[model samples]
Target: MNSKLVILGGGAAGVLIAMKLASQNIDVTLIDSKTFYEYTPALCSVLYEETDAKFHQHFSEISFELEPFLRKINVEFILGNAKLIKDDKVFIHQREEGIEYDYLVICTGSSYADPWKTQNGTECIDLNRRINFLNEQREKYKQAQHILCIGGGPVGVEVATEISYRAPGKKITLVDMNKTVLANAPDGIGNNAQRILNARDSITSIMEQSASQKGQEGNTYIYETDKSHTEIKADLVYNCIGVTPNSEFLQANHADWLNEKKQIIVDPGLRVTSNVFAVGDVNSVNEPKMFYTAHMQAIHFVRNMSRIIKNNTNVENLIPYHPSRPNMIVSMGPQYAIGYVSGIKLTGWPLGLNKGSHLASWGKYTIERITMNSCHLKIPVNEVLYLTSRP
Candidate 1:
């Protein structure tokens, strides 16, 4: 029998690897709890003024049936949560048995709480439904005279600006422990965001303050700040805090390969061991925890894995990862955005229209197409609307 290659997580990295290996007639099995892959860029963009029809179309378009796609690619799909990993074996709680493997690749990425970044496929669908319901409640959002947003991260800033765009008259209070918005970003980018945010009477930016939820009462939320015992009351609240790496499965083993925060440590070529590799957000690689980075790692790992399969891969020849600056387009609204690429800061309508528009969705879509094609799976044109592409 052929040596079995078992992959955990059907995320961008895992899916790409499965597609490449399965199409080449290698014995590969993919395990993931998510029914479909998510194009997160679109998710972030939708907080603006995306119509109901547009949201539905994009959500459905970005995610394809995970099981069917993998099966079509000749990769076995296992719809179960992975529980633990021993040397050369994986224990899945649902199966109640350990499965052996000649090689293992883990790509279980990170997640956010609630409406942010959900962990599994079921949670994703539930969140989508909630978003739909949330859309219906936009009236409530607008009716709320004051809105409090906790955390000044990308998502937090995006939500603040999006709310500012949709309901210009609504009061928005964006609070972060950092002294400035996008504190980790280039100084000019953060400064620019502050200028734009400050220019609006409806928006207020609070720095060096952390808030704790004081519970909700009659659709009203109360937050207490650390400094000055400030009490900020608002009608609606969004929590965009941090990325929690999905490495609970590794905790049981006291996995020395993981940091105290549970992020897996990977070698230069993105390997945990000679026969085991770790890619994407789950790994503590130098790269940012973004989908595109995972996709790129997938390509690099598979090329080396292909050589390994053919007994021509030299360990020394394996590609080492070099982290780069994250190029991002952060839209304050549908028509305006702020961005930075290679130390060059750009802000305007054109960047928003191109990189932050539905056109940007097409770029992610193309990557998904290439991934699915690698797996020998033909995503029907109907499955791919103008804005969604998936593996």
Candidate 2:
């Protein structure tokens, strides 16, 4: 009998792995909480009003070629949440049904680490809701002229920049407990971002001693610092602190497989345990948790899994995972962008052109296409690497 392969989560990593393995004639089942995959990178663009408010595109529409591929490979796609893994069988809880699987792959990704983590809450799905909340707060105090964004990370900086661009007349203050924005990034990238933000006419940045106190109401936000208490009158407050790994499903059965930060500890080959693996933001790696990193890891994991199914004992050594050089593109507004490519940083019109290029859009489409094709075709990574590296 063929071994059953089960993948949890339908995000970038999970779908990519399932597509790759199923193509190798392996039995594959993909389980996700939602029926459609949501594109998250577009959230930043939406906040700046660069993208439409209702710009949520379905994965099926985005990757139309994948349906036929999935059918050809007999890959079973289940819409449900994975509750736990026990005795090497995955326990899935659908709306009113339950199922089990043989081998499992965990790629549940991460969740926004908010202050209300201790309580039960609903997760925010799209950028529209976030924007709507901000707008509502702004309107609640029409006379209020200031907005404060807390946290100096990429998300915080992006949100502040978007707000400044969208509502130029409003005073925007960006506060970070740390000394600088993009603290984890290289000095050049952080310095460039700082300079750009400082040059903006409507934004002010400050380094606070601590993140003490909280709560915002209308035009008042009170925070305590190491030196003293500080309060700011703002129409709105936005928090973009960070994310936490989504590993709650593994707590009961695979607790030992998780690290102190609740991230799954995967081996160099991306295997979490015997005949099991983890990928994306849920897996602990030395690299930053970005979409690109997740994409690479998913590809590597699927390739290794395919080799294992072919009775190859040396599958683990087929391809050693290596971290790529940090590359990123940040948009200030509709036609302004800053980008870092292979250590070479550029900004302004050139960056904007690169960002708006059809090639960039097609590259994302190609990733989805390759992911779906992986379900029925074995496209070599060498070719993918070569194509992606082409200028």
Query: Could you say which candidate leads in lDDT?
Result: 1
Task: Give the Cα RMSD of candidate 1.
Answer: 5.8
Point out where model 2 deviates above 4 Å. 48-74, 95-98, 113-145, 214-220, 224-229, 314-318, 349-391
Task: Give the C-alpha lDDT of model 1.
Answer: 0.69
| Candidate topping TM-score | 1
* lDDT for position 44 in model 1: 51
Tens-place lDDT per residue, model 1, 1-391, is 5778898988777887886677663699888765566556545555444466665665665556787777777888877777889868888766777888988889888877545555543232333554565465554554677888888877777777777776788889989998778777653577666666776677888889899987778878888988866888898787878788888888788378798768888888888877788888889887567666677677667777887777756666686766544655555655556766445566543444322344323433454455445354432321232113221
RMSD in Å for all candidates: 5.8, 5.7
TM-score of each: 0.81, 0.77
For residue 4, give model 1's deviation from the true position in Å. 2.7
Report lDDT (CA) for all predictions. 0.69, 0.62
